[model samples]
Target: MASTHILSAYDEELKYLNRRISEMGGLAEQMCGDAVRALVNSDTALAQKIISDDVILDHAEREIQDKAIVTIAKRQPMAADLREIIGTLRIAADLERVGDLGKNTAKRVIAVQGTGVPRKLARGLEHLSELALVQLKDVLDVFASRSAEKAEIIRARDEEIDAMYTSLFRELLTYMMEDPRNITSCTHLLFCAKNIERIGDHATNIAETIYYIKTGAQLEGERPKDDTANTVGAPAE
Candidate 1:
């Protein structure tokens, strides 16, 4: 009876960990959406909200980290149990970075405010953001369901986001060359685009974490990386 009782409590702890991760994922997704909306619409108010909400994500990450460590020390979980906890930690880290990148993009909106950037260029960013958000949402679903196959699909599609970023990079360069006055605003948009691209990369990272959690084995072969990003100023901005 005592052993059963301990098992039940451990299960409850795992459930709580899952709940925390879900909340964090939801917030990360919203932050990115708001950041992009701010960029395309020039909504500084929404951008401010995204920046403030990033603090909430940071706190949530620390909370999850604390809970994960406590679960490890008290439960001493092994095998799949241990993998789930570690995987939660890894996903939380990526989600926090997602929040940070989104917040940075929001800040860019303020940087380029009143510059009269081209609507076509802004729309390009909006389209790229849409693709990234879909990837993030899908990967979060994979994490929740522990679906390795779905995770693999998400990993394979990361190259699509990189391709979108490279195309935007070239377009932005052309715009800047057409008008020297476009340099400042285009540069800001370049950083913003790079930030969204990075969020896509984090989604891919989460997919890998999910795969490892479900399989207990590292993914084989080199991850299908898009070398086009190397020419995107490499999506590291």
Candidate 2:
């Protein structure tokens, strides 16, 4: 009877960890979407709200870490059980970073205020953010289902986000070169785009963690990356 009771309590602890992770994932998704909307619309009020709400993710991460540490110490989990706790810690950290990226993007809203973003650039940012958010949401679903196959699929899709970011980076550079007047706003947009790109990276990290938890193996080889922004040179004089 005591053994059964201990097992039940351990299961409950794991459930609580998962529940907290889901809440953090949902909040991070909302913050990322709102941050981009605020940037495109120059909505300082909404951006400020996102910045303030970031503390929630930070708090949740710390809570998860504390709980996981205590559970590990108490249960002395091994094998797959230990992997699950470790995976939760890794995912929580990635989600916290996602929230930080969203907060950073929201901070750009104040910088670009009163300087209108071009419709073309706005659309580009929106599309890029849409892809990143989709990746984040999909990986969170993969985490919940514990499907290694779906996690691998999400891992491969990171390259798509990188490609989109590279395209937008070029477009922003062109806008800056064409008109000196566009430099300020375009520069801020560049930072915002980078933040969105990083959000995708965090999503990929979570996908890898899920894959490890399910399979007990780190993904082999370098992660596929196509961000060519660093390779592009200045336009011919």
Candidate 3:
């Protein structure tokens, strides 16, 4: 009947959106890596690459949004179908913000284009990048499978990222205070830490949005904070 055909089309749309989302994730993840590498090595070439590559992420985000809009307009979706469409759109917005955060980090890397990073600071970035990427990858899994439990798990990783960010923030602050000469380099590293933290946040935002689409529950104070991060991928409060 009409419902069956509608579902078939909906499934096709979800598949396409999922592919685009994964592509966005891949690009954002690479951008984060390139941004980090650019910071450690002061490689302007890599920084420039990340800046340029952001276009692909932006395009993917727009395409996903357009598809979601069209799907909503064309189909009189049932409750579950409507949730899936809304959820995917929300997730796409989060991925786009992820792209923005990566680009911002790259811009900061470009600013300190020739500065040498401290060894201690370099070591911290290694850990931060790993944690951030893991959170991002988990959200993609959540989207594909619609697993609320896995979404909750992304929040746990966000906590780990927060702790790492706080520790790194204090350490860098102390280093800058002790040696004014370290200020420029420390500031660049601070942006890297902050960008990584924000990436974790966007992933968290996607989790909460998807959870709400599924359950209609706002996961404590997750609502207001999500509104801020989804717009620009800025650090969550």
Candidate 4:
């Protein structure tokens, strides 16, 4: 009877950990969406809100870490169960990073405020962010479902996000070169684009974590990445 009771308590703790991860994931996704919306609309208030909310993500990560450690010490989970706890830790870390990247993007909105970037460039960023946000949401779903197949599919699709970033990189460069006045705004947008791309990379990392938890094996053969642009120039005034 004692053994059965201990097993039930362990299961309950795992459930609590899963809920925490889901909460963090939801906040990160919302922050990413809000960051892009703030950028497109030049909504400084919204951007500030996103930045402030990053602290919540930070606290969530710390909470998950504390809980995971305690659960390990108390439950002494092994094999797949241990992997689940470890995977939750890894996912929380990635989600926190996603929050940071989104915060960075939101800050750029303030930096380039009143610069009035071209609509086409803003649309380009919106498109890129759209893809990244979808990837993040889907990968979180994969984690919750614990489907290695879905996780692998999301991992394979990260190259598309990278390709979008590369294209935006070129477009922003052209905008700056064509009009020196566009340099400041385009440069800010460039950094924001890179942040969104990085968020996609984090989503891919989460997918790999899910894959590992499910299969106890990392996806081999070089996780796909497509950004190859290497030009860095001073921010235009």
Candidate 5:
């Protein structure tokens, strides 16, 4: 009876971790979406909200870390149980970074406010963010489903986000070169685009973690990356 009670308690703890992770994932998704919308529309109020809400993700990450550590000390989990706990830690870190990226993009809204983003550039950013958000949402679903196959699919599709970012990077550069006045706004947009691109990278990292948790093996081969912005003399700013 004692053994059974201990097992039940462990299960409950794991479930709590899963629930917290899902909550974090949902908030990260919302922040990423809202950040982009705020940027395109120059909504300082919404941007400020995103910036403030990032603390929630930060707190959740620390909570998950504390809980995982305590659970490991108490439960002495092994094999699959250990993998699950470790995976939760990894995913939580990635999700926190995603929230940070969203906050960074939100911060750029103030810099570009009143400058008016070009309609074409706005559309490009929208498209890039849409792809990144879809990847993030799908990867979070993979975490819930524990579907390694689906995780693999999500991992492979990260190249698509990279390709889109490269295209947008080129377009932004062309706009800057065409007019000296466009440099400041376009530079801010460049950083925002980089942030969205990095969000996709984090999603891919979560997908890989899901795969590891399910399979107990690291993924084979280097992650496929197609982001060529650096080679094209992309600014570090």
Candidate 6:
């Protein structure tokens, strides 16, 4: 058991950690949204904005990391609290990758712009992006509250995104075959779908990471069906 002062002092620290993570999550969500918009609106400025936001994500990760280390040294959290501090380091790494993916997607948008691409794939990209955002949003809720149920819901959403990605890919492949004119646009769309898929996966990983923080065990191989949630794919690992 930790001393009263250790836990009490850290109550504020934990809250701040959650707050910082939430802010980082917001950055990730915004990047995804902007990446989609840049593609759909053909706005190079928005794409450039997405590229610039990566610095925020990087800084957030470092800030949270330093705080976590300090908390560990000062508080000496054991059991669940220790897991949480460590797991946050892992989760931040995943979130950083997600931010990078958003940047990559934005770069793809810039490349395809004015290439005479129809941008028709923007519709599918929008759907996939929304799915990812919702999952990540749920993860944020779960992390702040340490609610296993909320984390479970996020896990389920990942599968649905996977299914959508598969379907979107098939549709894109068909389009590319139907018209060489669509090759450029569809390929870019494929990239966007891939990015969304990766985002959904990161969200799911966050959920699992939170679950471990709460329960002290990894929830990887066991995926339960949620009739209430639309999880048709492999429920993001």
Among these predictions, the greatest lDDT belongs to 5
For all predictions, the C-alpha RMSD in Å is: 3.1, 1.7, 5.2, 3.4, 2.6, 5.2
lDDT of 6 by residue, 1-237 (tens): 566765677998988887888888888888988888888777889989999999899998998899999998887878888898888888888888889988988888766776644445567778888888888887887888898777877887677888778777877788889988778877887787788888988988899888898888877666533222233243566
Q: Which stretches of candidate 2 lie over 4 Å from their true place?
A: 234-237
RMSD of 6: 5.2
**Comparing 4 and 6 by TM-score, which wins?**
4
| Residue 111's lDDT in candidate 3 | 63
Model 4 clash number: 0
1-237, model 2: which lDDT tens digit per residue? 999999999999999999999999999999999999998899999999999999999999999999999999999999999999999999999999999999999999988888878889899999999999999999998988999999989989999999999999999999999998889988989999999999999998998899999999988878989978777785756
TM per prediction: 0.95, 0.97, 0.87, 0.95, 0.96, 0.87
- The global C-alpha lDDT for each of the candidates, from Candidate 1 onward, is 0.90, 0.94, 0.79, 0.90, 0.95, 0.81
Model 6 TM-score, 2 decimals: 0.87
> What is the alpha-carbon RMSD of candidate 1 to the true structure?
3.1
Clashing pairs in 3: none
- Identify the runs in model 1 with alpha carbons over 4 angstroms from their true place: 232-237
Q: Write the per-residue lDDT of candidate 5 for residues 2-91, one digit (tens) a residue.
A: 999999999999999999999999999999999999999999999999999999999999999999999999999999989999999999
Candidate 5 local lDDT, residue 72: 99
Model 4 pairs whose backbones collide: none
- Candidate 3 lDDT by residue in tens digits, 1-237: 998997898788878888888888888888887788877788878888888888888888788888888887887677877777787778877887887887887788766666677888888987888888888887887877777777776776677777777788878888889999889878877877888888988988888876777786666654223222223334667
Ten contiguous residues minimizing lDDT sum, candidate 4: 228-237
Model 5: number of backbone collisions = 0
**Residue 146's C-alpha lDDT in candidate 2?**
97
The alpha-carbon deviation from the true structure for residue 53 of candidate 2, after best TM-score superposition, in angstroms, is: 0.1
Candidate 5 regions exceeding 4 Å error are 233-237
